[model samples]
Target: MSPDQFHDRMWEILQDINKNEFHAVAAKPPTDKAIANLATSTGIALPKDFLAFSQKTNALCIMAREELWPEAKLFDVGPAWTFHRGLVILGIEAEDLPEWANIQNAYESLVELYELTDVLPLLKIMGDGNHYWGVKQDGTFVEVFDGEATTLECSFIDTYATEIKELIQRQKDMCELITKRNKKQH
Candidate 1:
């Protein structure tokens, strides 16, 4: 699917899951000049599809769980309302965005730390700081774990959609299990 189609589909999924409530924070789309500047500054030739995606939204952070489940321990490190399990797509630094959401920062740090020159960090799986989904100059998607990279056969957007679906399913299952246990206790 094209980048625009993927973006629309992702929003549809998120909106449906949240019941039309906004559970995500998305940065304003960056200009073409800004994208060009980023490419020049990073020295990594960003893929055309990725650039297209970025134009739609520079970055996105979704807080899938607005509240903690009953009888569940909250180990998340962020806001009180956040369950901390969601999706994050890294992009250019914006004034309103946190430092960690900057694609340039992530890319440079990973490259410097791991001595990697091929992979560019793009997507971050919330709750885990060690793993990332990135793309190569050749447009191959890769999963990076502990600084080691493994190529993924699927497209980046497809993988991203799958991750969102899995997260939603897990949340649903947890809610069901909790309800069942509560019923049994009563």
Candidate 2:
């Protein structure tokens, strides 16, 4: 699916989840200025598809209990750095950088990695903020686990479409389980 299709379908899924299951926060679209600021601060060029995604919805937060995977939570441009921080920390250790150094050094490492790999931190995967769902420079999605980037099986839109569908199915399963228990109780 294209970015627009993904955006529309994601909103539809969120609306259904909001009406049926737990609360899932869908933030407002971000302004161009906001996106520009993020790019400047991070020193990484944001891909067009990702910029479009940000333009459609700034963030999507799933409640801890409501997450499809134990590690599924997405953030928008503003809070995206929260996930990047994890990457920085991971790089400090994974790359075996000495613990005693200027913090700026760590940040520089992250910027360089992003630039060299063409990967941008897009969302936090785990509620605890350890992992991230990063988008590649080519519009494909990747999972950033402990600062290591691995391409996912599909593109960004397909990945999200799959996620939303799974979330809806999980909601249905939970509802059925609840009704079945209630029937037995009565």
Top candidate on TM-score is: 1
Question: What TM-score fits each model?
Answer: 0.76, 0.52
Give the per-residue Cα lDDT of candidate 2 at 76: 33
- List ranges where model 1 is wrong by over 4 Å: 1-3, 12-16, 20-22, 69-84, 173-186
lDDT of 1 by residue, 41-74 (tens): 7677776667776777778876554453432356
Model 1's lDDT to the true fold? 0.71
Model 1: colliding residue pairs: none
lDDT string, candidate 2, 49-137, tens digits = 55565565445544424342223245433233222211111111112223322122333444565533455555543223335555655
* lDDT of residue 136 for candidate 2: 56
Ten residues in sequence with the least summed lDDT for candidate 1: 76-85
lDDT of 2: 0.48
RMSD of 1: 4.5
Model 2 C-alpha RMSD vs. true structure (Å) is 11.2
